[model samples]
Target: MDVLGQLVAVPTVNPPGESYGEMVEVLHSIMEDAGYEVSAVEVPRDYLERYIPQHADHPRYVVIARVGSGRPVIHFNSHYDVVPPGEGWSRDPFRLSVEGDLVYGRGVVDMKGGMAAAILAAQAAAMAGAGDFGTVELSFTPDEETGGETGVKYMVEAGLVSPDYVVVPEASGSGNVWIGNKGNLWAEVEVRGRQAHGSTPWLGLNAFDGMARLAVALSEELNSMLSSRRSSYPFADPREAAPTVTLGGAVSGGAKVNVVPGRYSFTVDRRLIPEEGLEEAERELREALERASAPLRSAGYSVELRVTSRSPPSVIDPRGRLASALSDAVREVTGSPPRLTVCPGGLDTRYFQLAGVEALTYGPGDDSYAHAADERNSVSEMMTVARVYALLISSLLSCPGGPPRSTSS
Candidate 1:
């Protein structure tokens, strides 16, 4: 708990780069003392020199510690970075406070808790003389928040992680196993119109008015489209089953109230299903927006759409051996079957899945606390996760050929 509390106290915020250097050093020392060979992978120099030093280097600093060397290697991956603490808090956001069973601090639940649990589990196994069936490796990378193109993406691209099966201790709450995640596409639409005095609105094209029309059309079309295409993950509430389209932000061109806005811009957030590729989704949205903006264009306005971020949707078979192994681990340790759910948002899981590695996200902590001030994790839950991870690694090692076991029906 003290170790975890120390990790929580270290602010590893991503935007301006947190004190990852300090956190990494601490983690390294912990693993080394536990009898594991540790190495530090540096972030790219160019990325370090930039304003965003953490991202500037595109660093893939992985602290790798192995117990044995061979096939059937089980790799545990987690990011050391976290999102900035958002508003609302009753105590110091960076300080880890223990009130009863809960540990309150930023990143405690988001991930640091999980990382701590994994480390402890490995340490326990080592102490017990649990001979490695194959190598057991833990990779602690930086930059998970902000979707910065550094951390895991760089590792995979650089051939750093080629484990047969990967487990990312992402926040999946207590009674859940994340089999997959929804894809996301973010795009900005800009409308150009002629500005005119508010008194003579007829003489000028109102960009805001044009944007308003587009928004309404998009809302109607998206509601119908998303509703008609409902799909459910075992963990998601059936009532909320469906892809969604949301207007995230909007900006008007004209500054003064008396002036008719000449330009307008709005951002869209689209969640996709596994069947749809990002390119296909983007094309469909562009077509819909273009059609809606056509009327405004005919009235002497122009509309443009640009994609900001496109993440492909990913899913793994819930019945697969990998899923079953994790499910059973949760059941054996927690004494309750875990709900298999699809993450409503995207995460690094997609990156692993795309690389053809069987992977899943499972960890203890209330995900609802992520990014919020006063984020926290339950001590009981963290300890339980540690025990669960130990069992999971043991089970995997015991199985012949180290293949994943089948899930219970």
Candidate 2:
């Protein structure tokens, strides 16, 4: 817990990911000291400059440490990056502060805690000569909080994640093993209108009014249309169901209070179900925007919709070998079976799934604490997660043959 606390104290916030380099150095030192072969790979400078300008020079390093050899490589993946510590903290967000049983810090619960546990667990396994059957790899990445385009996505694209099975130490609390996650599409809607003095309101078209009408129409359409179909995951709550549409930001063209706005813009965040791929979801959203703009078009207002980000949903076989192995490991370590659930939000698992790997999200800490002020994780929960991960790798290697054919993408 002390070493883990030290890691949680180093705030590697994304966009800049300032502490990524430092964290990689620490991981390298630890892995090397533990008698494991280690290496680091920096994301290309040109790519970083183009996509992540804020962290253009900051290296998004991957520290890979291996133990044992041969087939059935079990990869433990976790990101070192964390969301920016927002307002409201009782103590310093960068420093891990323990009050009784809970350890509080910005990234403690969201993921640093899980990463620390994974590393320590691997070290423990190495000491116990537990890597006898096959190999164990640890990949600590950066930029996971911002959709992982520069982190695991880059690695997977480069063929750095060719593993028999992958386990991401995400904040899945303690009881749930995340089997899938929803996709996301972010878009911006712009409305153009004619501006005139407020006194002659009839002579001028109000962009604000046009946006308001569009918002209402789109909101109603999303609530009635998108929320009708619920997910079939057994762990999903019936009342807390379905994909959702959220209106994020809205901007009006008017600078003065007395003028009729000429231009308005708004952003939409659409969470898609597994049945709808990224392209299909975007097409549906485009149709909705077009339908919503019809009223404005009739009233002589121009509307345009542009997509910002599109990510696909992912689902791994819940009853497959990888899932069963992880479940048995969790039960052996914690004395209880794990429940499979769908993550309501997006994560790097989408990238692994796209890369054709049998991957799942499992780790400590509650999802509700993610990105929240004074984020924290239970020390005992992290210990349990470490044991579960170690046991899962061991069980997978000991099983006859390797991962079941069904898990092979």
Window of ten residues with lowest summed lDDT in model 2? 400-409
Residue pairs in clash, model 2: none
Candidate lDDT values, in order: 0.79, 0.82
Clash list (residue pairs), candidate 1: 41-61, 43-59, 44-57, 47-56, 47-57, 48-56, 48-57
- Please state the error at residue 5 of candidate 2 in Å: 2.2
Q: Write the per-residue lDDT of candidate 2 for residues 187-294, one digit (tens) a residue.
A: 888888899898898989999999889988988877777766877765456543477788956554666888888988889999877777788778888887888789
Please name the candidate that would achieve the greatest TM-score relative to the true structure.
2
lDDT of 2 at 231: 70
For model 2, what is the C-alpha lDDT against the true structure?
A: 0.82
Q: List model 1 lDDT by residue over 272-351, tens digit each.
A: 87767888788788778877777788888898888878888888888876788888988988899899888888778778
- Candidate 2 stretches with Cα past 4 Å from truth are 53-57, 197-203, 239-241, 249-259, 403-409
* C-alpha RMSD of candidate 2: 2.9
For residue 203, what is the lDDT in candidate 1? 90
